[model samples]
Each structure stands twice: as structure tokens, then as C-alpha cells.
Target chain A: MSNLFANQAPLLRTKTAPAAAALIASAGIIYGLVLCCINSLETFAVSFLAVLLAAILALWTFVRMAVKENDRGLLVTGAACMTAIIIVTVMPEGLPASFHVYRSFVAAALIIGLCVATLCSAVYRLLGSTPVAFDNSRYPILILPIVIALISYGMILFVLCLNGLPQISWQLISTPYDPANAALRGILNDILGTFMLMLLTSIISLPVGVGAGIYMSEYGGRIAGIIRFSTMLLRAMPVVVLGLAAYGVARMAYDTAWQGILAPDPTIMIGRGTFLLASAFLSLLVIPVITRATEEGLRSLPRDLREGSLAVGATEGYTLLHVLLPWSLPNILTGLLLGCAEVAGNVTVIVLLCGFGNYGVTPFTEATSLAHFIYKVMFADRSFRMSMGNYVYAVSVILLIITLGLTIVYLVLRNKFAERYRAH
Target chain B: MPATVEIKHLSVSYNGTNVVKDVSFEMPAGKVTAIIGPSGCGKTTLLRSINRLSELTKNCRVQGEIMVDGENVLKMDTVLLRRKVGMVFQQPNPFPKSIKENVLYGIKAAKIKTDHSDIVKSSLQKAVLWEELEHRLNESALNLSIGQQQRLCVARSLAITPEVILMDEPASALDPVSTLKLEESIQSMKGDVTLVIVTHNMQQAKRVADYTAFIYRGELIECNETEKIFANPDRSETRDYLEGKFS
Candidate 1:
């Protein structure tokens, strides 16, 4: 009798383990939803709908598993129990507190019922002549979380754009800020400052990045490995740290300039952030991106192309300039455009190097970009947040438009250039 | 016949492994010399040594002497040596430029002062590609068919007006029809430009080469007039290879 029980125990545990785990996970999800709903009814309703959709999906999975495993009785029992629970939970005319209680009870019952049905099917199969294998029907359930994540992201973007649409106007974008009158405030200075910063960053980073990339890929031997590793590390480094470093360098330069014979007044030349310093820091952030892109672009070319060029008596320098560079122009531009988008949206670098002071398009003056301005208005200033919340969203929309436009252009150009050199 | 290029005890090694070992030969001027061997027998390495292109590979060590026009190629400026001795690769490779630009590329790279159109016309005519591609001179070279691209590469090489042109299995990538056309181009270039071609096809050697050199395992086994090598006295390995007993 003891040996018979031991044999039954192994079979029972193997058959019931997966069903038990799924039951516990589903119950936990239901409990979390109930707690969230108790805190906020609106949030509860949304989470409850999500859970309902998930439950339906689980039921579909069970049905598929049952069919594939040849367990029709278990499928019918699970479907009937789920249908009854859904009907009970959706019933009206109960008090709010009782309805919550009833729903939780129904959810608990449904999970237990499904788990039992799955275990019974598994045990039945395990007791048969064939070896019992877990059903593969649950694989499709893995896509649920990804689907939810995408929908949530799209929903947030849609809500932000919808909220900001009414406040966006040509005048709001084209005019300077009027701090004295809340109704007349605009973002022209921020727009110009962002464009100026991006232009400066591009000027500082493009040539250096491309040159380093070419050298690393072509003639750089052991040193190229070091540079490539360092570039990757720099790309992952925090933007704020880079901004601080740039700030220190600019301050030192300013102090040194003040000691010179032809130095201008320290009050005007120093103490505040300058456009050049901001752009220099931004270049540090973007150079890694451009360098990597350029390296990949150069690496993608067939070795035969370079050999062909060299065999025709073209020098290495001439081959790189006329053959490699021209062929990889689109990839370089895509990298540059991506860098431009980085420059436009970056707030940490700008806030630390270029302050929120309003300035013209001069490299030596303190600049305010759209991102930094939004941060200043939303987080730093109380009065501005209360009065200009819609304006902040309007700036966000414009920033979104610019970055999205650049990304679209990058993708389109990459495809077009890729088509040009695709081997037949 | 005068020798256009001479290899004296030439050996090449990549990393630590020797690929071409102590190969010595002289390619006759104003004629075709074919190097025939099984795959990986170092035929291409021997051909590339004439223009010093093998040195471009990483960790590739070249020893001994390669002389072109009585000057050691290893001691001469590589760019200048390469200008004098051009190469066509196993695969057809054209620059992503217009057809006319592809022909003019070598002329421009050499910094020569000459009329571009005349050189373009004559180079294309020499490769026998002018009649078909003359109307499409402005089109990108990439759009040309594989055979046409191979001819364009030949034209581009000819534009440099090299004293010796080295081809490494130039027809290996082409279909039979294109192979015939390439052979005709090589035949037409005889007595104008000295040619050294590496091929595995014995029939190709018989059809176009004035001299045939058989290399086995990175060593030259025999070098003789194509007729004598094919018909009369030769080593056992050469006979075995020509009769397709073993690669």
C-alpha cells in the first residue's frame, strides 16, 4: 500500500505542477487588480478590463490545449465554469461593496476551477499508455505583455498630443516670451536656441566623429580596439556627468581668459553658461553615436570594393574619399540626423552647461533650449506650471514633431541608399 | 622574348603560415602567361606579388624580390608600382560611379593630364564594351550586367596604361558566354599589354596563354611554352592535373 501511494504521488505532482503555478499567478493578478480598484475606481475599471481580456485569452489557451491533448471533457468543464463566473461578475443591482466582494469571489472560483480541470486532464493523460508531455498551446500567451506595453505607449502619446493640439499656434511658436503677460508668452527664443545648439554640436562632432570612425576601421590596429571600447563606454555614460565636465572646462577657460591682457569684463564673459560650452558637451554625447554608425557603415562595404580601388592604382586616402565615403554618405547623414535629434531633446546637458537665461544666436551667450525651458517651467517654477501647463505640452508636441521628422527622414534615406548598393 | 616581370625566390606568409613559398618565374613581354593550379595552391598570391598588393593584408610577410621593368617592386613606391602593373580581381568589381567615370577613375588617380573623353572612348573600345555601353556612359556602373561590369573593370585597368596587367581567375565568376568574351578581350590585348593570368581551367590556358606555369602547394613545378606544356614534355603532376586525375 505504501509503494502504491508513492508511485501515485510522483504522477500526481508532475501532472498538477503547471496548473497550480498558473492558478497562483492568475489569482495574484486578480488580487492586485482589486487592491488598485479599491484605491481608485477609475483605475480599477481599466485594470479589471485588462484582467478580463487576459482571462478570455487564458480560456482560449485552455481550449486549444484540451483539443491538442484530446481532453474534450476537461475543456467543456473549464469553459462552463468560466462562463458562469463571467455572468456572476457582470450581474447588476448589488451594493458597491457587495459587488466588489462578489467579483473577487467569482475570480477566485474561476481560477481554482480552471486549475482543477487542467490537472485532471494532465493526470488522465499521465495514467494512459503514452508519456505525458506539457501542451505547447500556452506559447501564444507570452505575446500578451508586449501587446499591452505597446498599447500603453501609444495611448500616452495620443493623450499628450490631443491635450496639446489646441494650444499650438503659429504665433505661439514665432514670438518671443512675454513673462509680464501670461497670455502673450511664446517660445521663439527657445526654438532658435535649440536650433543653434544643434548646429553647433553638428559642426563640432561630425568631422571628428567621421575621421575617428574611418581611422578606427581602416588603419587603426590595436589602438582601434581601445577607442571602440571607450566609445561604447562613453555612449553609455550619464549625460549629466558629461555636462558637469564641460561646465568645469568652460569655467577654467573663462578664468584663464580673464587673466589675459585683452580680456573683456569678467561679469560679461564669465559666470553664466555659454552656447559654445553647451555645444561642446553635446558633441561629446553625440560623437560615440556617429563614430559607431560610421564604423558599421564602413564595415558593411565588401572587401572586394576596397581591393578593386587599390588595384586601380588609387591610394588608400583617395580610395576612402572617392569610393568609401561616397558609398556611405547616407549612413553618415542618418547618424548625423539622429545626433541632431539627440541635441534637440537633451535637457540634462543643456540645463547644466547652458542655463535658462534668454539669449540670441551668439555662441558666447547663455542659451535656453525647448527641453530645458520645458523642464524649467514644469518643475522649477511654481507659477509657470500653474499658468503655462498647456504651453509646456505645446513645446513637447513641437519637440516630438522635430525628432519624429528627423527619424522618419533617417529611415527613408537609409532604405533608399541600401537599395542603391544591394548586390544582385 | 623579353621578360616584363621577374619573381626571384618570392615567398609570402599570412600570420605565421606560408601561402606562397619560393616561387621564381619570368612573365614574357607582350604575351599572355597563365598560372594554373588547384584551389589554394598560391597561384593568386604569386600573381598579386608582381604589383606588391599582397602586402596590404594584415600580418602578411613578403620576402625576396619582385622586379617589374628591371626595378624591384618591393623597393619602388607601391602606388607607382601598382600604376605600372594593374590587376583585375576574381570577381567583377566596379565603383559606384557612372560608366564613363569608372573608365576615367584610373586616369584621374594617376593624376595624368589627358583628355578624359578620348581615354574613356579608347579604353572602352579596347575592352570591347564601347559599342554596347557607349550610349549609357552616364548610367551607374552598378546597373551593368555582371559580364559588362567585368569588361568595365578591364577598361578601368587599361585606362592606367600599365606595362603589365595581372588577372586572378578573371573569368571564374562569369558564365560560359561571358568567359568567352573575356578570353577574346585577353586575346585582343596581346602584343599591346603583357598579361599574367592565374586560372584553374587548362583549356583556358591552351586557348589564350603563350606560356603556362604550373604551381603546386605554393611551389612552381614547371614553366614552359603553352604548346610544349600541353603536348610534350612535362612533370607527372602537370600531366595528372591536365588529364583531371586529381585537382
Candidate 2:
């Protein structure tokens, strides 16, 4: 018995020692990689080290899973990691280096690819094997890399926004543009015009979108199928195409003799790139999104609820208005907020329909939105480009903040409503 | 009491396949009538046809008359018919709303202007849930247990003051204790509202029903007083069914 114990102790020690050593080595490599990043090493050197670190980590993870755990999730994650590594290593050269100015596009791509690979593996590990349980045991180890990646991405954005912060002041925000001296110019009119456009677009889209959604889900039979199919197709249509269509319609309306009759002063054009027209065009783009969301919300409701309402003698319209709409309010709000965010970022439709030069606040006048202003400053006005580049970024930061705030509100409200209306 | 529901030569078909062939039955007012059968025997179809809910299905065809209170339900406006004859489904399907709101829903839908709190209290009392849920009127109805939700549905239906309440296996989804509670609730509802319930549980039918109707393969085999049906059924099929010879 004493001899057997001695043999088992050595065997256990031998098995654990190698695992401990491999773990310690992996930690050392990760520390070194962080140090290299902090020291601002050459891109090639950093990327090479990243590649090596990735390979080692992949090997360690695979060995741990295969030798110790024998988990099916590990197989999925290992395959994802290996695929990501291969894609990074063999990434084709000669793609336009539009975004990466400090490093070769390939090196940047490699780093991003590696980060993506790690994220994939982490997610797979978290999801667990066959029955698809959320394995909390692997949470810390698997989630760390993903958290780091997300934080780093946010940090980069924060840095860029901070760089643009100093360029913005009360003077830059409150005053109108001074084109004579671009340095003194502010985006006050553009800001007001953007808000006006967004307000009008929301007003035009929300009711119509929600109504269409309800119709498609409830009383719409064969015609509803067509509407749904078309909406999906419209959602996939390019923004530029929508802009062109809007432009065509506006031009046709401007040329019509009815506009002359409607206006006391016939010289004033009614529909040509006007704020209302642009907003209407933007609504066309946004409606599909809102409609689809509303449809999904309605569809998520149990059939029993609808039947229950009907069985209680509620008219179809009454049920839709009182029960279905209230139940799906959160989803509808989410859709509306998402549509607003889309409108805030959109420039193509506005640029084509409402010219970038137009900056006004009234629905009757042509207007330039924040995104359109950025596009104009970046590409059209060569003289203002260098001077207003930081200012453009500032506007972008504001837009980002607004959209992010809306998204946060949507998420909070979604959770609240989801809890309230959760089916048993 | 005069007949509350008279179903005459009622046949229900879905997409050209007949589910309930020509069937006739009369349900007396202020009594519980239980329809018992094996699964897929069209007992539910017959019950749904009384309120014209069977027509909600796509390509469903209904023939003949279902007279409720001397008015043919098929000829009646659907909203009015449904208001007159409320239904509780197999599952405990409470709307995702507050308990108070669920009870008030039917009244509001019917556009009846009355004291909302009084009706809510009375209806909940009828379902025997008011004592338990009195303090939690504002709480979401979905927070209730399955049995509670089913009773809440009963309260919601009663808020409309329907002449007849149809229950489709109302106790099927419940635990035995909840089922007993539900059966008690049903028993208490007698002499106030007419009830026609479809159930698979023979003991439950025997316990709560005044009249028991047996259906087999889209046909009505027998319907009689609950005691007589259980004691000495006239038909061999009914006898075999009572003896649990076939499920």
C-alpha cells in the first residue's frame, strides 16, 4: 500500500506540473504582449508577437480542452480560433488603406482578426456544449478577452471624441457659420436644421409605420404578405436609390402646374429639396425599419392573448388599439429610436434630395442635417476641410452621444416592458 | 328553465374536412353541461360553434343554426354574439395586463359606462378570486399561478355579463389541487350563468355537470342528466366510455 501511494503521488504531480508550467508560460507571454503594446513598438513587431501569442493561446486552450475537459464546446471554439488565425495570416494585400494611416492595412487587419477570433471562442465557450447551457464556470476566463476588446474599442472612440472636444466651444455651437473665415464658423444652423428634420421625419414615420405594422399582422391577408415582402425588399434597398426616387418625385412636384396654383406667389417652389420633402423621403427609409419591428413585436405575442381579447367582445380595432399596441409599446419605441438613429447617421438621401449647401430650420425651406454637413465639409468644401475637420468630428461625437442615449433608453424600457408583458 | 342554447344540425368543417358533423343539443339556462370525449372527437368544435368562434379559423365552414336566447348566433353580429356568449380557452390565457384591467377589459370593450371598481369586485367575487386578489388589483395578471390565471379569465368573461360561458377543458392545464379549486369555482357559478364545458376528466364531468354529453368521432352518441349517464348509460359506446374501455 505504501509503494502504491508513492507511485500515484508522483504520477499526479507529473500530470499537474506540466499544466502549471504551460499556464505560467501563457501568462508571461500575455504580459509581454501588453508591455509591447504600451511601449508603442513597430507595427510589424507588434503584429508578429500578436500572431505568436494567438497561436500559443490557441494551442494551450485546445490542449486543455482535449486533455483535461474533453468538452464539445471546446471543439467548436478551437475550430473558430483556428479559422480566424488562418484568415488573418492569409489576408490578401492591396486593399485600399483608407482607414489605417498609422500602420499597414494588413497588420491592422491581422490584429482585428485576432481580436474577433478570441471573441468568437469566448462566446462559444460561454454558450457551452450539446444542450446549450450557459456555463458560468468558464465565465471569467472566456469573458475577459471579450470585455478587453470591447473596452479597447470604446477607449479608442473616446480618445477620438476627446481630441475633437477642444475644437468645440460655446462660440462654435451658438453662432452661425462665418464662411469668410472658416475658423469662426459654427454648426448652429446645421444643428437646428438637423433636429427639425429629425422631428419632421419622426412625426411622418411613426404613426404610419406602426399602423402599417398592425395592419400587416392583424387584418392583412394576401395583401399583407405582399406588403411584408415589399417592406423587406425596401429595407434592403440602397439609401442612394431611395434618395434618387425622392429627388425625382420632388422635381416632378416642383414642375407641376398645381404647385403654381396652390402658391399665391407662383415663383416659390413647394417640393424641390424642401425640409418637408427631405423629411418625407427620410420617412420612406425609416418606415420599413419601424414596420418590421412592430410586426416582430406583434408576432411575438401569444395567439391566446389575441383570442382572449376577441372573446371578450373587443372589436378588432379596439383590441389592436388597446391591447396589442400597449403590449408592444416597448418594441415599437425601440424601433422608433433605432429609426431615429438611422436618420441621424444618414447623409446620402439628404445630400441628394436636400443639397448640402442648404441650411435652414423651417419645413418650407431646404435644410442641411448634421451628417450632410459633415459630408459637405469633408468632400465638397476643400477650403474648409482642414479647418473644420475637428469640428466635423465634434458634430459626429454629438450625434453619436444622442444615438447612444436613445439606445440606452430603448434598452431600459425594453427590459421593463418585457418583464411586464412576459408570457407565462 | 328555458333552453339557453339550441344547436340544431350544426356541422363545422375546416378546409373541406368535416370536424363536427350534423349535431343537435339543447342546453338549459343556469346549468352546467359537460361535453366529454376522447381527444379529437369534435367536442371542442361543437362548443366553439355556439359562440361562432369556429369561424375564426381559415377556410372553416359552419352549417345550420346555433340559437342562443332565441337569436341565431350565426345571424347575429360576431362582436355582439361574443359579448353575449363569453368563452374560456383550454390554456389559462390572461391578457398581459393588470388584474383590475383584465376584469375591466370586457366592460370597456363593450363600451359600457358603469362603476368600474364595483364590476371588477363583483366579477372577481364570482370567480372566487376577489378574496385572494383584492389587495393586488393593480398587479400584473400574468404574475398569478396558472390556476389563478384561469380564474381571472373567468372573472374577465363575467365582467361582460355574458348569458352563457363556455369553457374548453379549463382545468386541463392545472394541477390536481388547482383543478379542484377550479371545479369548485365552476360549481359556485351554477344558477347565475349557463356553462357548457368540454372536459376529458370523467370524474370532473360527474362532479360539476348537471347534464353530460358524450361525443364520438364527430357525432353525438348520448346526452342526459349526469347521474343517469354515469349510472346506467343507454348506449354500449357510452357504457364502454364510462368503463374506460377506450380512451
Candidate 3:
């Protein structure tokens, strides 16, 4: 029996052992996170934000003085961003109003003067790093994200304009919205907010993470065990954790101290408390996919492809943009698609951090999203009936249809680009 | 038609391990320059450096100058330089695109709007695929025969109107007839561009190269007029390699 088992071991292969071990390890990790989540251990957003910011500062200094924008920046940025997000989220009560958090859609961008100023300063500092390189022709790849932003902004603006929904800028920011109008407001708010979040952080991370991934595979080689390790660590982090941090710390001081008409005012969003927090948390949950996808896109390319491009006299950046990126577009898109899909399904963080209860914001409001709406229907009580109305199957079908529609669109565009490049 | 490539004191190392050391040579104008040697010879490295392709590798560090047309290609932008210095890879790697697009990629990226019809016809004409593929310009390049795909790649490279064209064992993948056709195509492109080719087949090298540089390990052993190097070689290693004494 031992001899037979030994002989059969070759067929089973040693790889299966590590894979099984990894599966068990991951299951343990997930179980632990879920346990932590279920225990309802309050994680304050401020501490994580502080840690993230400090880590970022120290990392930036190290990169400047030692590593020189080294391969680790992606991991660092991803971690810091995720950490700040998760901490701010999972533990906060007065998340937005107390913390001076202003959820900026397009209109709110004008008030984003402070942010733009900081960005401009960073841009200058960044340009200072490589003064004479002058090879930024591939900067246009960064421009594609702006298309998403513009379309999101444009669509929202067009809709608002079409519906004559005059945005209550100052009133909405500070006042408790009338209960009658809150549902329409919440639905409108959720869709536009999601579009903005997706366009901004999620989209940016896709290129940077995936671009890094491509770079890693092309150059990381057999010796990049450290890179592989850290990437795995970062990708393994839970999303609920990330979202809590972002929501808690950044918006803490600005959280509104609300007073009720019937009683003393509660300190939070006009009427909605947890909904916005949930949205931010969901963003955190989607990072691993983005980073991994980016890595995959970079690594999957053949060595000869890189060599061929370089042999023609294209620089690293140029080769990446023109050669590797174009080829890896589908992969990058896949990563983003998966991330978006995964994020769309999450209700845990939203339930915990955002107000998804009788007293909190309702999905019937314009700012509430389809996912939250579904959750609202599934969980809410009806008159001795399944609280949610009879639109469950239709809503699910719509979600599936939307995903399918997007996938088809992506595949079609990829084929067109490929077709555009194929030679006779 | 005439071009010269000059390499001086070139050293390339990948991850602190020297891959090519003290390599230097020059190819005469308007002639086939073949770098022939055993496996791991720095011939490919030397060819790659001429167009500054060596610099693209992350761990690769190169020290020296490669002069083409009195210009240090390393100092210039590689994208522009690569457009001017075409390369045919060891494997036929046609972009996952259509035949028409592959031929016009360089032209299109050049952002110079010209008559599409004229450009496609002429580019295919130069590659000798115009008649055969005149109807199939819309077909996927990936679906074509390997030999045809390679020539199409050659055509794609030629379409960009590069001054120097480098081929890394272009016919290594083909059968005899395909090899014959490739040789014929090279014959047609002889004086149109400065051709630097790396090949293992001595017969092919003799048939195609006007000047030959025999490299061993990471060093240039001998480079001279192809006839002199073949008939009256200076180095025993070159003779040994030519006569199949040892790789």
C-alpha cells in the first residue's frame, strides 16, 4: 500500500499540496475576517488614516532618498489607501458631518479647490523627480480615465438638467432633507456617487496596479519572490476594513450634528447616516482585483514581445503604452470588470457602517444604488408579506443584463482595437 | 539605401551579470551584415544595441555608444528611432489585428493622414503580398500561414519606411520554399534599406550576407567582407565554426 501510494504520488503532484495549503490558509483568513466583522469590533477611522498618512509620508521619503519610485510604490499606495479607507469606515458614528467630509460630485468639484491645490503641488514635486526626461508622450493613457469622469459627470449633469433638479448645494450639505423628498434624493445621490467613485480611485488604481503588474512580470523575473509575496498579502485584505477607514477619518470632523423635529437632532448626514459610508467602504473591497489584474496584465506578456518592442528603440514607457498595454488592455479591463462586479455585490460594510435601517437612509432616495435597493427590499418588513415588492426577479435580471451588456461592449471594443492592428 | 552601424566599447550586463562584454564592430553601407556564432554569443545583443533596444530591459545596463548615421541612437527617443530602425523578430509576432491595420500601424501612429488606399497598396506591393492579399486585407493576420505572416511582418516593418532593417533569424521557422521566398524578398529589399541579420545557417549567411561578423561568447571574433571571412578567415574559431568543428 505504501509503495502503491508512493508511486501514485507522482500523478497527484507536489503542486497540489501547496495549493491545498493555500486554500486552507485563505479560508482561515476569510473566516477570521468574517469573525471579526461579526463580532462588531469597532474600528476607528482616525487611527488607520493616521497610520496610512504616516506610512505614505515615510514611504515617499524612503522612495525619494533610497528606492527611487521603486516597484513597491504600488503596494504602498494600495495598502495606505485601503487602510485609511477601512479604518475610517468600520468604526465611525459621526463619519461625514463631524469630520468635515464633503462628498464631491461634479458640482462639489468647485469646492475641491483645496484638493486641486494639493494635487498641483504634488504634480510639481513629481515633475521635480526626473527633470530632464521629457518623455511623457504616453501621458494620453492617463487621459482615458478622464473620459470615464467626463462621461459620468456629463451624464449626471445632463440628467439633472433634463429633470430640472436644481442641486441644493448649501441646503443639502447642512440641512436635514424633508422626509417626503429623501427617497428620490437618495437614489439620485447613490448612482451619481458610485459613478464618481468608480471614475476616480477605482479607475486610477486599475492602470497603476495593472501597469505595475505588467512591469513586474516583464522585469520581476524568478528573483521577485518578495514582490509576489507582498502582492498576495495586499490582495488578501478585506474590503469592509478599507472602506471603514476612508469614511471614518476623513469625514469625522465634518459630520453634521443633527436635531430631530420630534426630538433632539442626531449628528450625521441631513437625514441619511450610513448609506454614504457604505458606498465608500465598497470601494475599499474592490482593490485586490485591480492590483492583481494589473499584475497579471504585465506578467502575461511574452518576453519576446517586450524584446521586440525595445529592439525597435521604444523606451520603457513607450513600449508599455504602445505594445504591452494595448495587448494587456483586455486583461486590465477584466480586472476592473471583476473588481466592479465584486464591489457591486457587497452589502456587509454598508450594513455595518452606513445606515441601512428603519431610522437611516432609504434606497428609495435618489442617492441609493440598485444593490442597496435590492438589500432594502430583501431585508425590509412588509405587511405580513416578504417586505420587498414583487420586482425582485426583474431587478436581478436587470443586474445580470447590465453586466452582460458591459461585457459585450468591452469584448467588441477589444476586437476592434485588435482588428485595427492585425497585419495581412 | 546605404547605411553604416558603428559600435564602440559596448558592454551590457543584466542584474550585474555581464552578458556582452567589450563588443565592437561596424557593418558596411548597403550590405547584409551577418553576426554568426555559437549560442549565447553577443551577436543579438550587439544588433539590439544599434537601435538602443538593449536599454529597455529593467536590469540591463549598457555602457558605450552605437552610432548610426553619425547619431547616437541611445541619446534619442527610442520610439522615433525604432520607427526609423525596423526589426523582424525570431518568431512571427503579428499584432492580434487585421492585415490592413498591421501594414498601416506605423503610418497611422505617425499621425500623418495620407490616402489609405494608396498607402495600403504600396506597402503591400513592397512586401510582395499586394496581389495575394489584395482581397484579404480585412482578414485577421493571426490566421495567415507562418511564412506569409513573417513576410507580412516584414511588409509591416517596411511600410514604416525605416532606414535600417534588422532581421533575427527571419527564416528559421520556415520550410525550404518559404526560406526561398524570404531570401527572394530580402534580395528585393537589398539596397532599399541597411540590413543587419543574425542567422545560424552558414549557407544562408553566405547566400545573403555581404559582410559577416563571427562572434563567439560575448566577443566579436572577426568581421570582414563575407568572401574574405569565408574563404581566407583570420581566426581558427571562425574556421572551426564554419567547418562544424565545434559550436
For each candidate, give its TM-score against the true structure. Answer: 0.80, 0.81, 0.60
| Global lDDT of each candidate | 0.75, 0.75, 0.59
**Predicted candidate 2 versus true structure: per-residue lDDT over A1-424, tens digit per residue:** 3665443211111223223333433443354335434533333434453444554455445546444544344355345546544554555433675423333333443444444443333433334322242344334456656866886888878886887776778987787666666565777777777777778999999998998898898777898898889888878888799777766766666546633221112243333476777788889888988898898889887878888899989998898887788778887888888788878888888776544332346776665677887787767767667656668778877777667787897899888877777655
Tell me model 2's lDDT, rounded to 2 decimals. 0.75
Candidate 1: stretches off by over 4 Å: A1-146, A178-184, A250-271, A381-387, A420-424, B1-3
What RMSD does model 3 have? 21.9
Instruction: Score residue A114 of candidate 1 by CA lDDT.
Output: 52
| Candidate 3 chain B: worst-modelled 10 consecutive residues by lDDT | B104-113
Select the stronger candidate by TM-score from 1 and 3.
1
Residue range B176-211, candidate 2, lDDT tens digits: 988988888887788888999999999999999999
Q: Tell me, by DockQ, which candidate is best.
A: 2
lDDT per residue, candidate 1, A311-365, as tens digits? 8899998999888887777778878998898899898876655444434556666
lDDT of each residue in B1-247, candidate 3, tens digit only: 4568788888888899877788888876667888898777877777777776766667788888877777887787778888778888889877666788777766766655788778788767766778889999998888889888888888878876788898988889998887887887887788878899998888998998999999888888899989999998999988988999983
Q: TM-scores for chain B, in order?
A: 0.97, 0.98, 0.95
Global CA lDDT of candidate 1, please? Answer: 0.75
